[model samples]
Target: MLNDTVSPDFFRKDAAFDELYPEHIRELSQMHWTPIDIARKASDFLAVPNARVLDIGSGVGKFCITAGFYHPETAFYGIEQRGELFSFAEIAKEEVNLSNVAFIHGNLTELRFDDYDHFYFYNPFYENIEPDSRIDYTIRTSFGLYDHYSRLIYQMLDEKPSDTRLVTFHGPDKQVPPSYRLVNNSSYSRVLKMWIKE
Candidate 1:
């Protein structure tokens, strides 16, 4: 069980955790990083003992680390396409001293969806076509790449067995396969959606 006191306030108070990155990266948290509250809630829902959970397009490992710490019984893995972000995630994981969280530097396409039982996604592909919300110019973002990734994820999720759990944050419902049915939603409405396969 996770300690309720290990909340956002607790993490934020730790200077090391809050200062994991430089000024620019820190500034991006409000827009890109998953909030601690959301991470805890999602982890609680998807964390089956010894189950594997994947964070699609995990930017800097914020979600993975927070969730892993709260739910130690479940292993959390993150796949990031950007090398720089992947590096930062590794360093932060070391600082936090967590062992269940791991990050891979590669595109989401390379991941084997069968390896994971549950998933957490934070609109990992939005930057591909949304010009205003682009994370950086380091990555190649185009409508074609966005469509490809979406289709890949949709198909992979479609193949998963029934009762597979998934949580999407600030993502379009269309990206999810129709086989998955909505289980519940946060009071925040569209921002956080929980689903389970039929």
Candidate 2:
């Protein structure tokens, strides 16, 4: 059980935070989930007071839960295509007791871009192109689906108003539109990048 205060100690390390989930879910942490530190850095750039941040292909809510826990004033929403992952995300959010985090069980294409003020993506569409990196066999993945999803997200981001924020972790740079300028990036690695629409 977690402590009542939910101190920062609980999030000090990825292994410590992975304890919130079951054993199998914990196993996927190294691959499918975002590290706590990366989540924090991404949230720092995306979180604006009262802003709604959406995590595309949020796999077990790791990004959303971490962001919501750190930034209570911001609402973090995650849309996951897998039902099982969505259930686990909801459970994790409940366990963490974060009111600002929400997990939606649906595809990214179904979401309305206008509903969110910012976005975070961790190469969600890569699984469609790389079979070895697939989270599971439950969802159909193909090169065609990857192209379609990538195109859709590009269009969505392109349609958003100026000043919309975006963070991409290990995602393809081509997916981001020219209108959104790269504002900053993690010095540790180029895998994490922050962008703002001009």
Candidate 3:
């Protein structure tokens, strides 16, 4: 069971929240993880009572954990391909004691989209094309893999039910299906966009 009243202390700033993880994981914050404010805004858009929001390519579980903290009624699930990141995500979630958050150690292609009602994406595939931006060498990175993953996500989103919500932070619009209408975008930056399936 989740606490009825949640504190906003951990979410006060990016630096504060990064303290939940180790030093190395904290160093990857700027490039790899979602900021606290963006996570809150994205969660507000995606959170529906009892809905399950999937964070595609969840790195270190930053987005999922933050979203889960703010929206106790909704569940936030993260699917990470890296085992180290997945393990760290689990540890952070335990420290936060958030029951609404869960992390899966697997690739996005292995998941069944039907299990989730909404999505949060943060340009998880960019590392494939940009060699310097890669998080690590644990996974294979190639332009071919990038196209394959992007196309797979596009197709998956196209098949979701009507009214399904999606939030993309720093993600390209091309990855989203044409059927998903642009609902709105964050005032903070054009990179954060919200969409809904028609």
Candidates sorted by TM-score, descending order? 3, 2, 1
Residues 1-198 of candidate 2: C-alpha lDDT, one tens digit per residue: 222345665588999888988998899999889999999999989989899999999889999988888888899999999999999999888888888899899988888778999999999999888999988889899999999999999999999999999999998899999999998858745899999999
Query: Which scores greater on TM-score, model 2 or model 3?
Result: 3
Q: What is the C-alpha lDDT of each candidate?
A: 0.86, 0.89, 0.91
Residues 62-94, candidate 1, lDDT per residue (tens digit)? 899888888878999999998988999998888
Worst ten in a row by lDDT for model 3: 1-10
User: How do the residues 1-198 of candidate 3 rate in per-residue lDDT, one tens digit apiece?
Assistant: 334455667888999999989999999999999999999999989999999999999989999988898899999999999999999999989888888999999999899899999999999999999999999888899999999999999998999999999998888888988999998867965899999999
Model 2 residue runs over 4 Å out of place are 1-5
- For all candidates, the clash counts are 0, 0, 0
In model 3, the Cα lDDT at residue 34 comes to 98
Q: How much RMSD separates candidate 3 from the native structure?
A: 1.7
Q: What is the TM-score of candidate 1?
A: 0.92
Candidate number with the higher lDDT (1 or 2): 2
